[model samples]
Target chain A: MTDVLTAAPDVAEIGRGVLVAVLLAFVAFGAIPVVAGLAQFLLIPMHAVRNHYRETGPYLPNVAVLVPAWNEAAVLTASVDRLMALDYPPDRLRVFVVDDASTDETPAVMASLGERFPGRVVHLRREKGGEGKAHTLNHGLREILADDWMEALLIMDADVIYAPDSLRKMTRHLADPTVGAVTAYIREGSEDAHGLTRFIGFDYLAAQAASRRAQNVAGAMACLAGGAQLHSRENLEAIGGQIDTSSLAEDTVTTFRTQLAGRRVVFEPHARVLAEEPAGIDALWKQRLRWARGNVQITSMYRHLWFRKSVHPGLGGFFFGVFWFAILLLPVAMLLTSIGLVGLYLLDSDLAATVFGAAVFVPVATFVFMITMTISVDPRVGLKVWKEALLFPGVVSFAVLTGATFPMLVPWGGGDSSGWTLFVYSWLVLCVPAAFLVRKLELTRWGHRLAPLGLYLVGFGPMMCAITVDAYVKEYRGAAMTWDKTEKTGRVSV
Target chain B: MSRGRTTTDRATAAIVRSLAARPYRISSPVVLTAAELAARGGVLPVWADPMALADETEADRLRERRLVAGLVVAIAVVVLLWTVRSLLM
Candidate 1:
């Protein structure tokens, strides 16, 4: 009778221990992505204070800009015009348009540039190699890497319209000698007018700004976007020029290689380029599937870098890739499972509301912090981004649908993006449903099987409506890297 | 036969190692020029004919595969446990 009297406190002590452990785990997960934003914010002032590129003007090297194109008639001419109008001296700047046997007006545009620029434009027509963008880029690099005069080469895609001073700003950073490749800020092109486009644009800025800022400070800038990148000839040769074109993500591998070879890469927010983003859900899914699978490919390729000394210096780059894969799977599962657990709790007690409120406070707090830091990057984006951030839960559900549906439809066996059909089908069918089901089950399980009521009436479910509303509200054409060609409104010089 | 072959190979390796370790204070342009000269050399090896080197590369690749396979098995065990828990839940 005496021992039974103190049993309540003993159970309370165990509950406290469990609560502390749960809190600690959630805190760790929340901090990983947030730390990246914090690191970038800290470095911004130091980068300004150091003024690393102050002495960069007088030592400008000859740069060969390679724009490899195939069937990009819609945007090729505007891109070439921007290239021609670059502020660098015509003699020092060499622009090569290697037409990958285009059946479109792209080849004609390249030919026309030759007559207009004379010696400045070099047109290389190559046979259609069924390989991919990476392969074409490698072929172009092979042609020019041996050219002793070309000091540094900027590899750019056809759809990328450079800011006139983009190369000029990027090159100054490269002159620091420690910096290997200077990748410009790639913004969404005007094609991003739809709901999906707006969400992608906002989410992209948040993710890139945070991730790059974090990695740059850690001395492990994982991957440089290939849309616009400046690489040194010597550094290129050190790693043996032109990445394994066979690699699904060539830019990511090259970024890792540059760092492993002891070269510092810094991100310049001022140097920017506008790119074409995917137009519809079909195209967007196809593009993101490539991106997702490519990320998987990279995670596989650089697995050794996670713990091996011989690999890249970025300690958690490979793990972060795994985290991205988890992002596609975890949220929905957690939500639904929590809902189920709550339902079970509600059945036993009248204190259901108290239990639910306590459990949800952690994710809500994390979401608030992410929103606050993102707004600090651009305060004007507060209400606009907040609305979109609110919609993130719904977008996540859609993403789950994308993640699960894609892999089953297009198994990874075909080897990279060359097999476009299977790749498109994977995201549309299997990955998409699988992701949605994860969320539905998580919500249903957590919400006592009233997931519909929970999603609509509860905290996370309302996020879907918020996301759709946010998408429509923020739907303005902006510049972002897209797989499809964008319809141009006006022309501005490079 | 073994003695002569070993002596000749060891001497050659020693000479090659010594040359490689030497600090050649050559500029980027000079090094590139030398590379260009070597490329134009009449006795230059054909691009695909380096069979022995390729064989050595393949052997190294095989070793890498074995190491990766061991790591994969360890990861697979973790995945299996996670899968079981997820399914049961």
Candidate 2:
């Protein structure tokens, strides 16, 4: 075998070609999202220079802000108080709180708010629950539509605390007859947020604020933020006033429908709202599963609409084809690439090392460039909350090590294959919702900074993949639709 | 919150459920073909309206600025990683 390895030059050339081919494939696939993402950096100047912001000098049409609460007793009164304090005409603005049969103090809070605001607030309490948010939203839509005096409908979550000027900022967009819907920028309010929330905060900054700003420059939106969605009366009527209640992502479907009806959806950056997110891993898992499932449902629902120019030129072509593809499938692709690199390493160690350097070079380079660009948008997180970004390299390094060991398993002869298999299997199983588990391990004598790496890998990779996979499984099983609400603590930091 | 269905999704899902739940055993190839057939429409757009963006020179200049910035950062990262690798070695 040694002589054979030293001898055959033709076979060696063939092997080199195969290895190079695999390496290139991995690079090319990884580059798709990177290129698309980097291309948005061109909009930095556009976002800076353009006068996208419009001053609302008395452009507030009679607006009805709809808040759908399931069991949101914690933050209902605070949210209602905030809504009452919006910088719009008190006579023109109305607040509607739909308490979807909450057993909590939500009904009482709504009642109190109703008493406080009197004519300005309408509290509609439904007797039944668990019908999902789309149904609850449709209930609000029906109630609001009955009153023609209301010109624009604002759909917001119970936990969303809009800035005083948020309504006015979002309201000005509807002055442009072409603008159908406007969505506000959502910020995580908790100052003392944990690791997962910090990562998610960074993600929101990059993905939602930065990316959508770029998409807005192109005169389209990937989707509107559900928490602070503002829809014009005419636009709502154009796409059928009723919210469709059989899929996971009502907002995404509505975004597509509005654009298909030839009205632009604006991402109002100035209109900022603070919304609470799942604090723990299990809560985050369930929340993300619903979202991932909703996205899947939208993708399935809009199969005929994707990339179709005649009906939805922007929504079909760019958002669904480019943005959605990158967001949903990139993780799976990266995971596959990781596995492939491992397999390649097992076959040819030298070639694998070279390929590994290339793999590391691409992502790290892209990430650095991206962070540099996106950080300019949110310097606080990019600079101050920088540990997550700093530890990312560690995550990437461990991912490579874990991946290389993966192919060592699979019963293809003996060795430490069993150990490799055990590590991989244990990681996959324990990694999801393992932050608390990891915290305990660290407290016990032997753990170190490796705990942070565990949080990133297990939190970002396995847990995220589990969300999407679970969503797909449920979809395949045709599980009944239920608005599995994320629990809120009413923890709004001023 | 979930449950926001389109008519097409509802219909397609119904058809899939019906076919899968049938007594007759379906071949893998047939099922795959049917699935592909269902996902057939949707044409891509080649030309998108520039959305009232008239200043080509400005866009080009901005693009150049971004390109230069990206190159600088990429170089810095590669250099940083190489230095670490050298130090380790």
* Native-to-model Cα distance after best TM-score fit, residue A6 in candidate 1, in Å: 20
**TM-score of chain A, all candidates:** 0.69, 0.82
Worst lDDT run of 10 residues, candidate 1 chain A, spans: A421-430
Over 4 Å off, model 1:
A1-58, A307-312, A315-362, A375-386, A395-494, B1-89
TM-score of chain B of each: 0.30, 0.35
**Candidate 2 deviant stretches above 4 angstroms:** A1-27, A40-45, A54-58, A318-320, A381-384, A392-453, A457-462, B1-89
- Listed per candidate, the RMSD to the true structure in angstroms reads 18.4, 15.1
Model 2: clashing residue pairs?
Answer: A246-B5, A247-B3, A247-B4, A247-B5, A307-A316
Clashing residue pair totals per candidate (backbone < 3 A): 39, 5
